[model samples]
Target: MSATTAGGEVVVRNAQGLHLRPATEFAKLAMATGCRVQVRTDAGDANGASVLELAMLGITQGVTLRITAEGPSAGDAVRRLIQLVESGFVV
Candidate 1:
């Protein structure tokens, strides 16, 4: 895939933050994006396709996360992921 990339930042709004369930949801969406996704926080960064890594971030409410994606559909991936985060991981 080409180096197409997109990035954005979003704050955790869910009272529980990015827990296992949310991470699972996130990872699934990320994998469906057809792009490689990376999520960065003050704690660390994690592969967006990995639920364990994302949950391990221990992100709590109010934490701001930087999300970046590379490969085809990066822009759409970033936008949709940001929207998901903004929705507090609601389906």
Candidate 2:
């Protein structure tokens, strides 16, 4: 078996953007997927499991982000995360 790489783009829809709470949520989910995940904006990228790194990206609302993951679960991980961001980080 080989690890695969996959990604998806989503606009930050939460009113407050990827703040500590949402960033924490995103990080937790990313970690749960057991993938080498990354999230990026036009300006910079961050490790998906690091809330601090995600916050440093300054992901304001409406900022488009590309999330990539490399692992056995890459594709599903990308889809799962994209849904979270698209839903305004509801859960």
Candidate 3:
């Protein structure tokens, strides 16, 4: 079998956007999934498993983020990640 890939776009709805706490949460979730994850924006792309990389994107409220995942659980991972972001990382 081959690794699968999944992706989706989500807009930041949090007032603070992706601050450290949320970024940490996002990275932790992405890492925990054990899949390759990438997050992209107009600024650029960043490794979804890296908080520093995610912060570097400078995401802000209303910014549309594109998340992609590849691996055994790509579909589920992408869906959950998109849900997380869309929910404004509200826990």
CA lDDT of every candidate: 0.93, 0.93, 0.92
Put the candidates in lDDT order, highest first.
1, 2, 3
Estimate TM-scores for all models: 0.95, 0.95, 0.95
1-91: candidate 1 lDDT, tens digit per residue: 6669999999989999988998899999999998999999999999999999998889999999899999897988999999998998988
lDDT (Cα, tens digit) per residue for candidate 2, span 30-87: 9999899999899798999999999999889999999999998799999999999988
Q: Candidate 3 at residue 62, lDDT?
A: 94
Clash counts for the predictions, in order:
0, 0, 0
lDDT of 3 by residue, 1-91 (tens): 4689999899999999989999999999999888999999999999999999999888999999999999977999999998888888978
Clashing pairs in 2: none
Candidate 1 TM-score versus the reference: 0.95
Clashes of 1: 0
- Structure candidate 1, residue pairs in collision: none
- Please list all clashing residue pairs in model 3, or write none if there are none: none
Q: Kindly provide the TM-score of model 2 when superposed on the true structure, using C-alpha atoms.
A: 0.95
Q: After superposing candidate 1 on the true structure, give the runs of residues whose Cα lies further than 4 Å from its correct spot.
A: 1-3
